[model samples]
Target: MDEKGGAIMLEELAFEIAKAAHAGQTDKAGLDYILHPLQVAAEMTTDEEKAVALLHDIIEDTDMTANELLAQGLPDNVVEAVEALTKKHNQNYAAYLAGVKKNRLATAVKLADLKHNSDLSRLEKITQKDRERAEKYRKAIEYLSK
Candidate 1:
């Protein structure tokens, strides 16, 4: 395939991997798990950012690993941005948000993620854990805005 084709293929592959990884999963609102990544990707301004957004939860929520992402031919920067967006186990929300803020692309993706996760309409279905997460995201938004 040509260069352009390869790029397009990679993009498609990223979406496919994300969909497969999150299959059978659902959000707090009972929406398909894939919708979150799709929405995050839609909010991004660049292809690379969208790619990172699409795979943001793969490492944390699925069996997919960072090494697998690289082996699948994703660019180093995209992988790095995805990594930055992923929260490490036991890491504080503020610390994870700090990493996201440091990376421009990751910040963009994370802001979108927070926006979707914190939507007012979703409040009715949210649990205590969701409330805490939303609060953290709100704080992160403020921190990132500065």
Candidate 2:
């Protein structure tokens, strides 16, 4: 397949995997969780980046494994980026962000994810916790930006 066709296929598979993985899940704002990935994917400029964006939360949030994603015909780059984006058990958020920063694709997707998550308008009501979380995201963004 041509590169374009290949990218489309990867993106489609990532979308399906992410949707199924997040089935019945809702974000803090009570919106369907898949919307978050879709929003992040929309901001990405390349197909690989879009696929990574779509699947970023799969390993961390769902039972889906990176090997399973790889076995399904997704490219190594996409799987690796998703893996980099996944936060491991007991992993410090700063350390996780540092790992994410090591992968260019993951870094782009994470920045988009953080920006989307930082949007206060997404929440019906803002709280002190929400503000604090947003501040953390801001710092992550700053760190990743550097």
Candidate 3:
């Protein structure tokens, strides 16, 4: 109806999409996968930022495309940020971070994503591989923090 109402609906839609897209998925810690995006979105300040955060992993992990999200009525900026946040299968981590840094919206959401991802406490058991991944996330956080 109004501007604020539209923003709320957008974020709600993002949440619904993310929930469905990640259904039956679990994180490395075996927690429900949707919690990651929910936590990331909670750290965002604006509705659009929250929406982007919620949908950030959709395209990367699911069959959904950016165009599909656009068709669902998400704003272009939100979709663009979500698209930027998606790292291609063949893309290097550093290169992906570089692209993420180029978009302010994606950067903010990514910082939150990295922050959540870096928390080893979320894992049931810490392993070499987990530590290594956290280290990589730490560096990405450092790079994105600048």
In candidate 1, which residue pairs get closer than 3 Å at backbone N, Cα or C atoms, i.e. clash?
Answer: none
- Model 1 TM-score, all chains together: 0.87
Candidate RMSDs in Å, in order, are: 2.4, 2.6, 2.4
Candidate 1's displacement at residue 25, Å, is 0.9
In model 3, where do residues sit more than 4 Å from their true spots? Answer: 1-8
The deviation in Å at residue 41 for candidate 3 is 0.7
Give the winner by lDDT: 2 or 3. 2
TM-score of 3: 0.93
Which regions in candidate 1 have their CA more than 4 angstroms from the true location? 1-9, 123-129
Candidate 2 lDDT by residue in tens digits, 12-120: 8889889999999999989899999999999999989999999999998989999999888899999999999999999999899999999999999999999999999
* Shift in Å, residue 69, candidate 2: 0.4
Taken over the whole model, the C-alpha lDDT of each candidate is 0.84, 0.93, 0.92
lDDT, model 3, position 82: 93
lDDT of 1 by residue, 49-88 (tens): 8888899899999988898999988889989888998899
C-alpha TM-scores of all predictions? 0.87, 0.93, 0.93
Worst 10 residues of 3 by lDDT: 1-10
